[model samples]
Target: MAPRDGTPDATGAHQRTPGARELNAAARVFALLADPTRLHLVWLLSRAESDVSALAETVGAARPAVSQHLAKLRLGGLVESRKEGRRVVYSLPDGHMKRLVVEAISHADHQVTGEPWHD
Candidate 1:
């Protein structure tokens, strides 16, 4: 099948398209990020590893709400946590997630500020 972008697969053989399951997984991740609070949490985590309290204070959200968002993010594989003494520090698992959040915020900023899109 033709790839979604209409480009040949990396193999340079048949065009590889994303299957329904792959699309659904991506959609589910986007759905999880649809919340402003969650997106804020992700943006913060993208910067550095932080605990719940720090995340809450930084985002101006309640601790519980931030914890809940962190929980969801952790479950979705967007973030990972490790026990640091008595505190559980959360951080983005990889650079891919960080780039995704950064690009999303940049896009939003452009739209909000009426800036022209740039490559």
Candidate 2:
């Protein structure tokens, strides 16, 4: 198995190929992000941390639905949450997830607007 970019090593050996477990885990992440509501929640979180109430209002979803989506994202390891007094504030675990969400949205914007993609 070659790298995802399919670049061959000079020595002709597989370099850092993704294992089945890693692929499955990544698939789970993508699956969780497949939902529009979850993607919106993640995009919002990418901007800043917020509680469920604010997320619900911003995304025009009910609190329970937003909570459920947050729970799924938390379980999927795409987001993390911590209690702030009576509220559970949610955020992306690291900068990588934020970059991933931002890039995904940018790609979608290009696709929707028929904009030229740049390298």
Candidate 3:
């Protein structure tokens, strides 16, 4: 069983503690997520794959700005894009990433609503 504490559980035989490099990489991901525009784009991608125009319209940002954020996210491996004929659709490549984004937003909602935290 997993540990009740926040530390990684040791119950699994295949599990290994994260190294400094791994922790640094996670920190980088958090740094990228610190930006509101990028976070919004990620949140949108977590919902559905969207093209540049649609993403810009939905996020209420200019096309160039949204395209820039998407470019950065793509480079960081947080998202992936595929050519859908004339348009390129963007999506979160990993299910874990979707869950992470949703959880972060939910945490923020809890803070804003003054709700008690739960595991």
**Best of the candidates, lDDT:** 2
**Candidate 1 Cα misplacement greater than 4 A, ranges:** 1-15
Q: Which pairs in model 1 have colliding backbones?
A: none
In terms of lDDT, the poorest run of 10 residues in model 1 is 8-17
How many Å off is the CA of 102 in candidate 1? 0.6
Worst 10 residues of 2 by lDDT: 5-14
Residue-wise lDDT of candidate 1 within 44-74, one digit each (tens)? 9888889999999998989998999999989
- The TM-score of candidate 1 is 0.85
**CA lDDT of 82 in candidate 1?**
97
Name the lDDT of candidate 2. 0.90
How large is the C-alpha RMSD of every model relative to the true structure? Answer: 4.1, 4.9, 3.9
lDDT of 3 at 23: 90
RMSD of 3: 3.9
The deviation in Å at residue 13 for candidate 2 is 18
Better of 1 and 3 by lDDT: 1
Tens digits of per-residue lDDT for model 2 on 2-54? 46554657754346678898799888989999999999999999999999999
TM-score list, all predictions: 0.85, 0.86, 0.86
